[model samples]
Target: MFLRPAARRLRADHPLALELAVLVLALAGAHLWRRGATALLPILSRAVRVDGLVTRGLLAGALLLAGLVLYVGVYALLRDIDVGLSVPSGRDRRSLGLALAVPPLLVGLTKLVGDLTGVPYNGLTMSAYGVGTPVPAVLASLVPGLLVGACSLTVVCQVLVQGTFARVVDGRRAAFLTTVLTAVVLSRSTGGLSAFPARGKLALAAAFVLSLGLALYAVEAVERDGVRYLAYLPVTAVLGLVVVSLIAATESVAELLFGATHVAVLGLAATSYERTHSLLVPAVAYLSLLLAEETVVLLFEAGMRSW
Candidate 1:
């Protein structure tokens, strides 16, 4: 019943003017929030006790956990009113498996691309783990990567853009719009249109588009064919290689990993919402992952500094 109504609404002629206006407003809001957060970071750092490794780790973890809670609360409040947001429903083990598998594969693909392109891949970008045989530094850096994966305003904006795209369009257009808009929004958050060299930014944007397109395809395949969705692997791998290669050419390995992982997470979140008609599941899962990653990275960075 809910699915039918939601589908019908998506197919109906929604006014493009209204949609565009809303999109502009959302973009503006996202920009302001990102700027505000950036500005607040210095003041927050000064106010918080971060002199020691333990203090820094605790502060970082607390802040990330707070953000996760805020996001979950917002999603819960908006779920009922927005067609794009949904309540969790039946479980799909296959979707869950796919979601779990995607992140590691993305990390591996980034490493492979970096090797091929002769880019120095710094796996421990968040921590100085290699300086000495320090257990705390290793734990601090690794724990976060294994835990949070990475969560930022970029991810929040992505969910908003992709969810909105799914509500308004279907098929390829929806996928394209989701990817393009995410890139535009994330780029703006990072440094506006002129942040990087034109060529570098273009390459990075194209990589995001390609990676997201493959991710969308994977989600659709899994939904339609279940286990037989393994058929999509080759295509996914090839596309990933191209996307990573482009990223390697234009950015650091850390940036490539972040982009690829974010796309994978976005795809997982979108697919989960589509399958279960619930935003809560994905939101919870994402926040949990992000919290873990942030905690580990912060701990590692603090340890490295103290050591």
Candidate 2:
């Protein structure tokens, strides 16, 4: 059932690459046609519309570019850290310090720009609703989730680097990093100028402590045993449910992959948890959970399309 042989033949012939290039050209042409067509349409209203085509295009492009830049930048930054992610040396505390500094910097910049531009503060929407409630609101709310997820993943990624991928062997240290990462990311996202005051700082602190403690313990256990994946059972179940729901509703492959990327990173953590009896526990646990979640969703999609 493997496609490697076929893939090799196609690759060697360079046919698949040419087809991919043609497909991309076709898609780009279609996108420009649709966009320009909509923009060129004659105005039919007697009322003065404040928002014009140029404004709409600019807004769309800016939002898209911002999201892309954030994704690439965040991933690259995490990749540079010496957190022993893929292999473990000692925890590169310097890299850890730098890693911890990132989310706040992002938060500050986003807030400053948002305030200066008079953009609506939508950061609180993640606490109040899931992405399925309303289409526009769901899409709008995803930005914060993406930002928060990026920050959270960085911690988790660092934990993976140090505990599983890197030369470090301390599971608890990895867990500590995990908790710190989560706290820092959430704090940055919640407190900056756009944050809501409803939860209050006291509550945030309490939540952080509870989350940190549990996360640290979970990681420590999962690193040492394969069947010990139970530490992340709650997270796995919740994320699995979310993935299943999205697969049932969304049609776009890009959206599915984007949603699943979070799950995939978590899965990496879970895998490390299952493999190493050392401090890599929580990382493996999370990675396994993520893998299960995303794989289930992807399989379901495949089945649906086959039918």
Candidate 3:
């Protein structure tokens, strides 16, 4: 599955360590090349702004690379689970449609609900001022009411009728990766959570619990399509609510608890045995990053002089 020449060479015998070492050496060489004769100097000792575009790009790249590594790792682990994983029939179109549609429908409905109720929904930030209220907020408040409602109905119908891709991935690691990839995609599309009130933490906590329940319900839905055909209902409803809450409840305690690493830990826990639940490892990593980011942002803000 690897496209990079270096990545392919590193994959010769489960050589994950060798792959990492090679990547590090390549990066170091590139840095040295860029710095020319000054490469050996103590440039690494300089303090750097972690929130800058370059840093963001690096983080994004690392995320992509980590995802690739995890995908391969999961595939390797799947061999031990005794389930043969393969591509699903019609998976491409179905997945593409679901991926493209879910975000807009969820985000749109949030905007519509927020407008009618005066509650924050989707990415609507009240504190970020604009010339006569934010234009996006105004549009969000109105258009989604009708458009999103129709789209949601359409998606629900497709999910109920098509019953897409429930058979191809049976291995535990594959299952975990599926959930993680979904969560990560959702997280990126949901945007930053700096707009939420501190009180929204309650909403966030509730949403997390609800998402966990929905994950279980989704498994059941795949199993039962009994005479009632009501299996997908609960899954759709809980997921819908969770999606809205995730986008609207940014910057709250709930967001911190359900962030990327937390989501990964949850997926891993669900896929593995109870005794193997290592959630705290990802929790600590996330908190450390948050601490580092907070330090940099605080220092930068403190240095700014108010006009």
Candidate 4:
């Protein structure tokens, strides 16, 4: 019962490497496409006429919707995740409750962390790179901003990265790989790594390598005791450092792997809250996170990640 509710359409027949490749290609292509296609963001950041805004908005929406449709098609082809395209059964209601609740909890706790830390981000760094901060613009227009967030986050991070990758890697390794890779991608996309001045970047890299050696030792010791989740404290540190990373760039291998974190987490979350392999749970969770995310664009970015 528990299993079906979350993995109804999640059987994998493709070889591990092939599945991994397909997932990476699909999501990367989608992100690259969205990054290039997002002309509306520029409009949002600055003033534009109503007619122009409407026209640009429509174009962006259509483009985003097309990408979403393409993602759904890929899921259907590769994982049979057609949202099950069916009516919910009696058993689904409990899962539905979880679908509604968990995302908010995740977002809230993350936001709380940011609040405690004053909600700093790559905002200053991003601005330096000529990329206007998106949170404020997103707030300015609820519908358009949300449309971008939902479609982008769902396809790139939640479904493909968090959901699909987890199917291949399991246990703490799943979380470890997920977190590490996500951190890498975020660092690239946000200039987290690049933000450091020349010497600082080298220092950041050295610190990371040293910390990782110690973490690997710790991971081995703790896992010997079985299922200890907190064993990856260093991984959390990596993600946190990414949050404080002061630079931004694009299309790095790290960024791609990072997107995988979103795929597995959201994929699992969405399916768990429903009795079908539908997008409802993941979609709603991500959408809600977009709203709740404000400046804490950690796990979910609503849509805009690179810029």
Best by lDDT: 4
lDDT of 2 by residue, 1-307 (tens): 3345434444355442323332223223323433543454334121334276544544444444344334434543554433332433354333333323433343334334444554322321122232234545433534444443343333334432233222333455544443333232223322121111123332433343333334435454356665455555654554465446446643443333333333333343433432333223333333232233222223222222211
TM-score per candidate, chains pooled: 0.50, 0.22, 0.27, 0.47
| Candidate 1 residue-wise lDDT at 280 | 54
Best to worst by TM-score, what's the order? 1, 4, 3, 2
Model 2 bad stretches (over 4 Å): 1-133, 140-148, 151-172, 180-307
Query: lDDT per residue, candidate 1, 114-170, as tens digits?
Result: 556653233323333333446566556545533332333323433555455555566
Relative to the true structure, how large is the alpha-carbon lDDT of every model?
0.46, 0.36, 0.33, 0.47
Error of 2 at 284 (Å): 13
Error of 2 at 259 (Å): 23
Stretches of candidate 3 above 4 Å error? Answer: 1-56, 67-91, 122-307
Best by TM-score: 1
What does candidate 4's lDDT look like per residue over 9-80, in tens digits? 223332343444454445445545556557555665355443566566665676666766675467756774
What RMSD, rounded to one decimal, does every model reach?
Answer: 12.6, 23.7, 18.9, 13.0
TM-score of 3: 0.27
Q: Rank order by lDDT, top first?
A: 4, 1, 2, 3
